[model samples]
Target: MKFLLTSGGIMNKSIHDALVGMLGKPIADCNALCIPTAMYGHPWVGPGVKAWEFISGKEENPMVNLGWKSVGVLELTALPSIDENRWKPLIQETDVLLVSGGDALYLCHWMRQSGMADLLLSLNAVYVGMSAGSMVMAPNIGEYFVGWTPPDGSDVTLGLVDFSIFPHLDHEMLPGNTLAAAQRWASGMRGPAYAMDDQTAIKVIDGVVEVVSEGHWKLFKP
Candidate 1:
């Protein structure tokens, strides 16, 4: 699986270009599935209008609004009740998965429960993760970002990538998300990590990682 992990969605041209490059085709030619499960787990994000905005392409973040050939919702929370045969092929046939931001641990829980975590390794599709969606790929999200906790009460996640991410670095709305705060967060990570702004994205293809940014980002080493 290829990854285009963003602090925000494809917020800038560079990130958009990186996504298109990963797809090897125009956005209009590809089929996509937007996962909104994470939003429900977040208190500030929702089980309401915010989730609807994301799915309907009305959200400020650019995931579902990219004008793909087709866009469908793949709510992870609802997957466990249905037959795998019904959804597995939909995922395999889709060109990309647009995962939304919310609570990383909560998203991780559903991803595991829904069996999407296991299936991810075998898929050929590109994965576009926003905020917590991107964070869920790391080994751990660190204590600071833990919003919704899993039953086992671990900050650990999918570990799909070698490094952790500190997203939305210095955004105005998140006044507390300064570089200094990120430094403090990085110290606890005890591994390689990145602090990226909304305009930045980290692209991974065949195990090679590259920073695609129009804004600013910093890589911290442990």
Candidate 2:
């Protein structure tokens, strides 16, 4: 899986340029499978899809738009409907699973409930993530900073990658707290743990990890 973890929305042209640098070549050739898992706001309908439309250049928005064909749209916030067994086949067909930015905790919860989390780690496709989409893939969602409170009852996620990915490190949160908190969290892990800043990505091919991007990636080992 090739992950593009960015800091917050693609609100600026430079960030968009970075994203385009990674995904532009691949997405430009095929109809991509875009899954905006993070944008789970109430009246959970538009935020996720709209963000993707802008990135894929299927629509116009001031944010990053890459002009890729969006073949599928899955709003994980819609929960149980997305969890059914029938949807697995569809999820399997996509050339790449692109996850857009939103609430990390909420995205994790919805992915767990919908069974998409497990499906993703096991699937044989490119997994692209931005912001919260990046965090949910980690061993823990870093709730202390992201404020991941379950709807009074559930706290579940697939825990796919055994690392705590620091989404948007260059531009989100106080740098000291973000790094210190992340380092503290990584110190306790039994396996490899990483906190990557924006424009940085860790590529995993058949489970072998290699850093690939334009920023810094710090690996913390206890």
Off by over 4 Å in 1: none
Query: Which pairs clash in the backbone of model 2?
Result: 7-168, 55-66, 56-67, 56-68, 57-67
lDDT per residue (tens digit) for residues 1-222 in model 1: 999999999999999999999999999999999999899999989899999999999999999999999999999988999999999999999999999999999999999999999999799999999999999999999999988879999899999998999999999999999999999999999679999999999999988999999999999999
Residue-pair clash count for candidate 2: 5
Question: Least accurate stretch of 10 residues (summed lDDT) in model 2?
Answer: 59-68
Regions of candidate 2 where Cα sits further than 4 Å from its true position: 1-25, 41-64, 82-86, 151-156, 172-178, 188-191
218 Cα displacement, candidate 2 (Å): 1.4
Number of clashes recorded per candidate: 0, 5
TM-score of each: 0.99, 0.70
lDDT of 1 at 217: 95
